[model samples]
Target: MIVNEWCMYCGECAGVCPQCVIEVCETGLKFDEQTCEDCKFCVMVCPVGALEKDEQK
Candidate 1:
């Protein structure tokens, strides 16, 4: 996923992820890309619209 500068670090995305691929850290979010299922739950739940699919991947 692509986490933009608008991210608020609310942990909403990480909470909704069924795959548990997203982690909320002090600095930012970390995505386990290899384990991701491309569910986009994180994208949809991001209140600040920070997360998006990396189409280039």
Candidate 2:
């Protein structure tokens, strides 16, 4: 997962993170795929719409 500059630091993504991959940080919100279970729960809850999965295509 990769959080771009568009991140607004909203915690919505973290709230629903099943794997707790998303976390709010002082610099900004971050998404750690290492802890991610590939469950897109957090991706669906981002209010600022800043969260995104790493495009593997």
1-57, model 2: which lDDT tens digit per residue? 767677777688888887777778897876676677877777677666666777782
* Backbone clashes, each candidate: 0, 0
Query: Candidate 1, residues 1-57: lDDT per residue as tens digits?
Result: 889999989899989999999999998999999999998988888888888899888
The parts of candidate 1 lying over 4 Å away from their true place are none
Report how far residue 54 has shifted in candidate 2, in Å: 0.4
CA-lDDT, candidates in order: 0.90, 0.74
Candidate 2 Cα deviation (angstroms), residue 13: 0.5
User: What is the Å distance of residue 1 in model 2 from its true position?
Assistant: 1.5
Please estimate how well model 1 matches the true structure, expressed as its whole-model Cα lDDT.
Answer: 0.90
Candidate 1: residue 2 Cα off by (Å): 0.9
